[model samples]
Target: MSRVADVKDEARSRLRWFAVHGVVRFFAERGIKIGDPQAKLIADPVTRANPGVVYQEIRDRGKIVKGRVAYLTVDHGLIFDLLRSDDYRTVVVGGNLPKPLRAIERRTRTAALHPLAPPSLLSVEPPSHTRYRKLVSSVFTARAVNAMRDNVQQVADTLLDELVAAGGGTVDIVSSYCAKLPVAVIGDILGVPEADRDKVLEFGELAAPSLDVGLTWSQFREVEQGLEGFDGWLATHIAGLRDNPGDDLMSQLIAASEDGVYLNDRELRATAGLVLAAGFETTVNLLGSGINLLMNNPDQLARLQDDPSLWGTAVDEMLRLESPVQMTARVAKGSVTLEGMDLEAGDLVVCVLAAGNRDPQVFDDADTFDVGRSNANKHLSFSGGRHYCLGAALARAESEVGLRTLFDRFPHLSSAGTGIKRDTRVLHGFRTLPVALGEPATVSA
Candidate 1:
């Protein structure tokens, strides 16, 4: 009887996965065939790889262009306003979906917690979001991030040292340096054991595509499995932290209380898991993209070498050129008119943040990479308003220190081969950055 029940459960799980993701994929592919910009942007890999063209196409259409599925916007000012507007919400609810799809989604909902699902910071509204954000905001503040600079520097130096010891002919910098630096720092903050850090990275990589709109069965399966493993591991880790806590951020979170009401077990897992995964994923992309940008623009690299003070602005420039997070979505709370376009309740608006970062109206010479661009900081790479990236300071610090230390150590570092971009749509970054780590600079006597 137990064996039969196990088989029945597996069948139901597969059916739910199909109903939730496969159905969406089927329609998205049809939309792509018809040249729907929004559909292509979401479902087509080629379009995702070269999204600048589509971003411009949407911009040319209008500030608020209606798509077959959702409305699209690439205007910096408009996107900025919408993100901060109370008229919009993060998660898509019943109002946005067809009756059939909504019923399927409701039935398919499982116990698994998704980063983009409710209870996660990315999906909650004001009150819950306010409470969750407050709990973790202090640790990521400018002052707190500044305190972690020394530790970041130490991690960068150690990684470079290992590269030198390897005799330095060629190495995939993404795996060796760019990815490791931020992960080490975040791991220390989150109390993840060093031996298990690689597992965390694996789970994060597999689950990353969950942020996208549609997925194939295989992709959806991999993502669900990854989330399951992470959920189990996190539950155990939290239990251990409760038994014997440390000074890490995870420990602090465990001890934290709001109005004498601590977070419940499910809420704790959701919050902690988000911190652990988000802590390093985007920073890894920032570092990888920063390195690639500097390598491509030797003139800009020379400027950084001449004046080290420019590293800060240089990091901002990199963000402007290649934002780690490319886009986000919001749902209309009720009937509203924006830029003369009427949006009903539950309408979805896709904000191409990468395009907004490069809006000519807001940025001069937007396509060109300029390290000293005065208004580089104005870019919406970290997003805006209440949902802005909590770890912006840490990502910036890591990118600046990581890039400066790398170039300073290996002044002649050059690409060994063409870098491979990540196979993700929402998160833009390199999967493998192969580089020849030239001889290190000798210290003065």
Candidate 2:
């Protein structure tokens, strides 16, 4: 590209960064008021700025209230009941969105790909949800996760190896470390070949925005294109697995489906997309958020640097403090009363997963970031009941290994520049995190 083109591209990037920063700053200062009793999360800035306060306000009003969609917040007991209750159904796959929005999604062609692009597991209710969930549960069991510890450690080391070698005196942890590790591990788990890593990584990002219900038409077009690429590759890959079976999860899925008791070809492909995308997206946020929290809190960073044993609990604390998935949607399966609020069948209910994690009734000093907190393990970073994150064990292993190995290597790591926040509401984390390793120590003469 010519210098003129390069300059234009750079200019655009700066403008976008400033625009996002401005909106964030605006919400942070002015604060948001949900005058509409039935609030809907229509934009990213409000939730991104301070969802905790918003949730608290909603929760204070009663157990549930009207909005664009009804919201359940702050009350862990109510939220848990809703999450685990068969009375509620998933928003998208369960056919809960308003007719106009659902029609719009279908017209965009993006909705058609939802089952496979995000997979049915995260969005569908039982019978189908149960079958899909059971198919992959064995692969992520406690014993299975324990077995991957060595591989997780090795991947962490390799990524950190690249970071220290190329970082000189600084690195962007999001791109250089946190983002790369989870994708690589997912690739390994799914049996993605080394030669296809670049394509897998590229498609992973393009396909991710489809998971959010707040996407615009243009965003839907982009997501459609991404799903086309991902689904095409997945279909062909499943075909290959059939021709030549392997020990990976993909092959297992294929064999299970052949019995006619599990998912068919399309469902199998959808399940694969869901696992890979879900695995990569959430785990990346957990690592990035954890590291960012530690950097901002030197005392906490020092504690971890002093003793690596605390790394496990520290990851939990991070999940509690900065949940990756902020809220999830559920629709009333049938008319029912929650916290004394009556709802008709098909009413939408949004569960504030992160807010519940910080509920004062369940957690002591709920607003404080304390890594040593005894009950950090009780966080709802992973949803509860039937839809609980199937990959919880694997995520914990990957994050614990990644964060532990990182701080151990760069004890002097500190922020070198401003970090940019992602422009999404449902998932939150940095787009980039610049840090300096304090110029590697000079050896004494």
Q: Identify the leading candidate in terms of lDDT.
A: 1
How would you encode candidate 2's per-residue C-alpha lDDT over 1-445 as one tens digit per residue?
6999878745543433223232333343332263542233444355457666567777778767666445555567778887788888776541554465445334433233564223478767777787778777755567866877888888988777666677557778888888888888888778888787778777766666655554554554466567778888888888888899888777777676423686778788878888887888889888888888888999988887777778889889999888888778777878898777788998878777788888888899998888888999988888888989888888888999988878777777888888887766667677788888664433234
Candidate 1 residue 268 C-alpha distance from true site, Å: 1.7
- List TM-scores for all candidates, in order: 0.96, 0.86
lDDT of each: 0.85, 0.72
How big is the positional error of residue 71 in model 2, measured in Å on the Cα after superposition?
3.5
Q: Which stretches of candidate 1 lie over 4 Å from their true place?
A: 1-6, 92-95, 443-445
Q: How would you encode candidate 1's per-residue C-alpha lDDT over 119-226 as one tens digit per residue?
A: 888889889889988887745567777889999999998998898888887999999998889889998888889998899889888888878767777887788788
Please list the Cα RMSD from the true structure of every candidate, rounded to 1 decimal place: 1.7, 7.0
Candidate 2 has an lDDT of 0.72
Q: How accurate locally is residue 134 in candidate 2, as Cα lDDT from 0 to 100? A: 76
lDDT of residue 219 for candidate 1: 81
Q: For each predicted model, how many residue pairs clash, with residues at least 3 apart or on different chains?
A: 0, 6
**Best candidate, TM-score-wise?**
1
